[model samples]
Target: MKHERGLLIVLSGPSGVGKGTVRKALFECKDTTLQYSISMTTRSPREGEVNGVDYFFTTKEDFKQRIAENKFLEWAEYVGNYYGTPIEYVEKTLQEGKDILLEIEVQGALQVKKAFPEGIFIFLAPPSLKELQNRIETRGTETEDLIRNRMNAAKEELDMMDAYDYVVENDKVDSACDRVNAIITSEHLKRERVSNYYKRMLEAE
Candidate 1:
């Protein structure tokens, strides 16, 4: 039997939009099957973080070398650190008929869209700009200047929302997860996907 290539689901949003929190919740569900694509970063790992699991931490020199070699499907430098998705791992997993989920920043996601236009792009949005600002302020890890800068950058990111295939507001994590799962399910059941399988089967017969 021929294995069908799996879906590439990209989830992105502005900074401080709880992308990590939402992704963690989504994967914890008993029915979730999407394989999380661990990204590579040039930043220092936080306490208790595991290499090749939370993120594939690497040196800036090595990361730049990989970028020069076109090893990444998409990459972007942010806050003096580089983050990217390794193309080889994603391609191999999809070839094995396993769905891959990429939770990344807006800039990285846009790069992925250009390289993999067929991939499903989901924009995770906050309920409102005020609420987004509140979320950032609530973090308390960033300085006032940094928060202001992030808010400005977020406005720009929100402008790019039209580029995504679907928009799910993060009013509540559970609701957002439900919408994302539903979108993936519908994509799998789309006529375009199923019809290709049926065509190949008939040709084989």
Candidate 2:
């Protein structure tokens, strides 16, 4: 039987909407089987962050060279650093019939949509804009000006929710993970995805 290409699950939303927190929790779950597409970044690694596991750390020159080569599926610059998804690894993984998850920023996610419309896009939204601001404020690492800027960016990002196939509220990490897992399972079961498998089985019979 021919193998089916795996699903590209993109999870994104406003900056402080907890995309990373939820993604980490989801992957830790025993039932989660999606392979995470490690992102490439020009930023220095944080404490306890492994080179390849956390992110593919690289220099600005190397990252820019790849961009010129058009090797990124989606790339974005933020806070004076570059972050991008490599097209090679993602394509190879999907061709092997193993689902891959991409936790990215909204702008990068939109770019991915243009390249792979069949990919599942999930928007992780905050309960409310006010709550989103609170989350950013809670971090306490950003200066007041940066917080204001992030709030402005969040508003614009939230407006793009219509582009996503699903909108999941990040009210609680565990609850959000449940919703994300359920969405993945449901997508796999869609007739359009599994119909060919059933047809092949019938033909074999």
| lDDT of predicted model 2 | 0.91
Global lDDT of each candidate: 0.91, 0.91
Q: TM-score of every model? A: 0.92, 0.93
TM-score of 2: 0.93
Which run of 10 residues does model 2 get worst, by summed lDDT? 1-10
Give the lowest summed-lDDT range of ten residues in model 1: 1-10
Q: Candidate 2 at residue 204, lDDT?
A: 100
lDDT of 1 at 101: 97
Cα lDDT tens digits for candidate 2, 106-171: 889999999999999999999999999998888777789888888888888889989999999999
Superposed model 1: Cα runs more than 4 Å off: 1-3, 46-49, 203-205
